[model samples]
Target: MIFRHTRLIMGTALLAVALPAVPAMAQDADEARIKKLEAEVRALQRKVFPGGDGRYFEPQIDSSAPVTTTSSSPASTTAVTDILARLDALEASLQRLTGQVEVNSNAVRDLESRLAALESGAAPAVAADNLLPDEQPLPAAAGPAPTPPPAPAASGPSAQRLAAVQAIAKPQTDDPGDDEYSYGFRLWNAGFYPEAQQQLAMFVEKYPRHPRATYGRNLLGRAYLDDGKPREAAPWFLKNYQEDRNAERAPDSLLYLAESMIALGDTNRACIALAEFGETYPAIAAGRLSNQYEANRKKVTCN
Candidate 1:
């Protein structure tokens, strides 16, 4: 009976040790699996949110204590539920912020387009429905009018001449300010030199800082030259060239100025002007000026 009692006690002690060891082995296995799952989750997060700089939420588990098969206490379950609820709220807040960022980005692009148009002296594009019936533009004339003969040279600008130069009325449009310049350019091309000069003068007065201001000034000089007033044209050409040498019309103004100087019996200055034109716009094609540069060069006999 004593031997049987001793055997039973030894068996009980061995069972106690074996039970604790099994739990410890299970805890170690669970920890290894959790670590492997965490690594995979981190890799997925890196791909899903490359801009997040590895930031993410991970639930904390106590590694110091061994896990068991026992059911969780009520307090622990409640805490886990609260944590899940907070994570859901955080996800919703992030979505709202992302939406707001997209909206702001669109607003910024719209503002930039408007600012660029304003700087370029171009009116913003209006929807067709927003325009009034009267705001509709009339069809441009099929052909330009015949050019009149050049006026006679005068010792000075007369009162009648000045009045004629300022007589053309500006037309009204939905974007009247912008269209006024176009109207002047069309009138000039249509051979209405006096009216063109007047309209261009008005444009310069109104939109002094406009992007097309250089074009208006250059065309005004051409009007004076075509009207047989070389003396009057020279100053306008000089002004256009001096104001903005890089303007698209600047080289043309210089070329015309050289022609005007020749007409005014200043061949030395004309030759100098032609030299400057060649130096400033070396790559400019002859087609751009309708071969006027070559013709002028022949007239002055430049070397």
Candidate 2:
């Protein structure tokens, strides 16, 4: 009976040892399988998101959520920042250019206004001879009155002498210094534009260096402007202004230049001319010319 009890105890001890080893083996196998599954998941993550850290088993965040930053290289980040800064600077530069353009535009508009005023407000030129005729003084009475002569008979020679005296007293048309220009000016004032143009052109050719040359040129331009032929008028105005910028008709010429430019759809040159007029003749700003400039500037929408 003792032998039988010993055999049973031995068998029980062996069985306990064997059972513990089986559990240990099972745990080792489970660890190997878990490691293999982790490796496979990492490979899948690499395939799905090539540059991402392979933490596939981790809980995922919502893709639609906003991200504050990305895992980008520092150099790349810096380059992106520099690009943004450059864009900002470029935008600022563009804004400055736009502001400068606006300033220039305003300056041009102001200049145009002044030019229009000067041109529109110029007074017509009057010839020096056209002023009041010379007044004749009455003959002074002698200290004692002379005795009156007997009345002469109305005979043939006496009548002929009287006729000659009457003819001499009649107003003469042949004033050497004042015929051509005066006639042209009269025609212009009377709205005989075609005849006036012809007369004025002839006068300009005949008396190119006369004191009234500037006035004649300006009047010729005016005739074209008034006749609605601004293209033809512009050259005359420009000529007058160029010939004698300080002459009485010079401002008139510049004014007409702007007007003709506007009429011809050459607003850019017209604006430039207008601006120059203001700069050249700052003194005209407070005169009637300024008023005329303002009116024309508004018409062109200069700014």
Judging by lDDT against the true structure, name the best candidate: 1
Give the alpha carbon lDDT tens digit for every residue of 1-303 in model 2. Answer: 546544644654554445545577775754554455444444444344534453543435434455334223675579789999999999999999999999999989876675454344222223566645742221111112111122346633356554643343222375533577777787778776755677777777678788888998889888878888665576677767867889888887787778887886766657766776776777874474888666657657554
TM-score of each: 0.43, 0.43
> For model 1, how does the per-residue alpha-carbon lDDT over 1-303 read when each residue is reduced to its tens digit?
546544644654554445544577775754554555444444444443444333542424333445433223575589789999999999999999999999999978865553333222111234688877744321111222112234458755688866654564556777665677887887787667776777777876687678888888788878878877665566667667766889878888888878887886766667767777776687773467748888888887755
As a TM-score, model 2 comes out at 0.43
Candidate 1: residue 245 lDDT (0-100): 83
Give the Cα error of residue 72 in candidate 1, in Å.
Answer: 87
What is the alpha-carbon lDDT of model 1 when measured against the actual structure? 0.64
Those runs of model 2 whose alpha carbons end farther than 4 Å from true positions after fitting are: 1-177
Name the regions of candidate 1 deviating beyond 4 angstroms. Answer: 1-175, 285-287
- Model 2 lDDT-worst window of ten: 139-148
**Alpha carbon RMSD to native, model 2:** 26.1
